[model samples]
Target: MSCEQVTTTYINAYYEDMEKLGVRRATLEPRATEHIADIVRLVDTLLTKGMAYRVDGDVYFQVDRYPAYGRLSKRNLDDLQAGARVDVDERKRHPMDFALWKGSRPGEPSWDSPWGPGRPGWHIECSAMAMRHLGETFDIHGGGMDLIFPHHENEIAQSCGATDKEFARYWVHNGFVQINHEKMSKSLGNFFTIREIFQQSEWPDTVTGEMMRYFLLSTHYRGPLDFSDQSLKEAKSALNGFYDLFERLNESDPSHGAADQLLQEATVRTRTAFVAAMEDDLNTPNALAALQTLRGEANKALEAGLSGEMRRMVRQEFRALGVVLGLLQTDTWRFKGQVPQRASGDAESTAKTLSDEEIAVKLAARLAAKKSKNYTLADQLRAELASHGITIEDRPDGTSRWKR
Candidate 1:
């Protein structure tokens, strides 16, 4: 769900995560580029108040007009100027003012605007676009902490100055992702994209999606997440053990029976612990510790040969608690098969041979049958596919795909 792609698959994944927490979905997921009209209007309003100016076909905001400019980041304006490399623009009243729109350049996207058909700058885009979707004021505005200074401060100044309304009631920022106490960077080679990490299926104890989630939430949202192969391996081991217990519970069959009173109480206690942790400004490490403690309790129950009803209750409880921390949502580890071909030089030829159209068709049929309330047909299809070592995820997007 980035700026470029807004596919139904992304929506389905979002809803899946929401369902795990039993939370209602937001009314809209507006893309910043889609709200050009709102952005243009806001920039125009800023210009009317003398808070913004147009220079070289670009609109720039007047940072000095706002007396509270440095309040958010708690830094002195003079100190900022002393440390910064101020660009001299004759049209700008002050050098600290940032651009609201950038004049069109070769190879970059552009749109029609009062500023001579240019594109909105990054900070202005969020302020205008979020206001369009969430109204002039919203309960929460969140992003990575790196955006706090200059970017968020500029957003607050522009939006509030335009609408004369409180921009956001609450501002939340997540911590950084560091590697070995050093900030991750492209030059240092510590940077790894999600796709790159997903490619490491060959190594035993290599982190999967579930383990990655656990490893990520191992630190509080306000704390730094250190990247290391050893930490990820430990997270993988922890997730594998939990999955094994879950598979066992799903396999064993028994009639409905009352779960242990203590087990039910444990469910409530675990959820309470999770909520308390999250309420304290998303302390995910404490929340994750709560999840792990519940896992231990469930393991004890399984080892004691608890009834199917008890196992089911524990399963449902864990699913609800796991979502807020963004863990235990997918079963990607089961598909730890061979890695896909890399686009070295034979990418075109490999694509022709490796595309799974036929298998995808069969999976689609099975999904269709299940959706039609044919459990018998679905079970038969699953059993048939089990022979081929392929796993299927019946997504809400009306498309079926196999992984293995």
Candidate 2:
């Protein structure tokens, strides 16, 4: 596919996945760089400042002049030159000098530039787009950790050289994802695209975008992430637990017992710890640990017959933290079909969906048959439910619960 077609498909899938995961942005709508005038104007400013110059129809940035060029990545110019590929073009003033605009070849995309009919280089496009959407100085700049070397470094050098101001206040880099101890790549046969991951639905335990999002948060943002089937399964389980807790709390009656002081105290401590973790450079793993603590405390309290207020508090704690983490926002009943979860592999996909009224009638009929001492009739009703892939267990207190 062409670049425009590929980008449209990718960005649409990206926005849809983000929306399902409860992530939204004030901006990030579609944009284009078709206005060659703006790009030409930008090149004119850089050329006027003498930080950039044209040579043989190609424009290059003079890296030697930008003193703080390596401040972000902290590599000295000498060391960078030693580590970089040798540039055979002795015409360049320095080997580290990068392209700002490249003269168009036979059939490549071209735009009218002061130098000639050419195209903006990769680094220049990023700098231009950033300054266009956000001002010269913005709060944060983020990309993959691999981009720190040339892509982000060139962006900083160009943007700051033109505006003579800090480009972005904070620079955030996310770690790369490896597959089973190997770097994921198309040549390596391990690379998985956003569409590939989300489109997997044949297997009952297939990972969803929800699980993929959870797997991303399983480690720190700056830490190397390993993408494997096991990791996705674990992420699915972890995410499932949150929905499980939501369902449990929803089913329990909070009106029976008194206000649980112990549960309330746990909530405050957990929140405090969570806030501290976030302040400490967005330590998501530690913050998630704090949430697990609250989940544990809430489970223990509710299991011991805590009051409705206690359940409410527990639900509130989960809901509030979930909002911050962008998880568990969907309704619990709708998570794995319209019922509580069963201890099986992906019940939502395997089990038949049923309405609330149908479940109620089945439960009532089973109860009536059991009350009449008609074991055969009760067994038949139980077998009928099993046919629909629903599982039910009767309590000693004469109550029965069912889930699919």
Index of the highest-lDDT prediction: 2
Per-residue lDDT of model 2, residues 1-404, tens digit only = 89889988987888776664446765655243654565577778888999988898898899987999888888889998788766547868888888888899879878777798888877877777778878788998889999998889999999899999999899899988898878889999888875555555322222265677778887999989988778887887677667667767777563465438888898899999999998887898888888888878877777667777677777887778767877665565242432433333465445644556777798899899899998898899888777666667686568887654
Q: If scored against the real structure, what TM-score would every candidate get?
A: 0.70, 0.82
Once superposed on the true structure, which residue ranges of model 2 sit more than 4 Å away at CA?
1-3, 20-22, 30-32, 201-207, 252-255, 333-404
lDDT of each: 0.72, 0.76
Tens digits of lDDT, candidate 1, 133-242: 77899999888998889788889989888888889899888888898988889999888755455554332223355666778778777678887777887877777666
- The per-residue C-alpha lDDT of model 1 at residue 377 equals 90
Candidate 1 Cα errors over 4 Å, as ranges: 1-33, 104-110, 203-207, 247-259, 302-305, 329-404
Clashes of 1: 0
How well does model 1 score by local distance difference test? Answer: 0.72
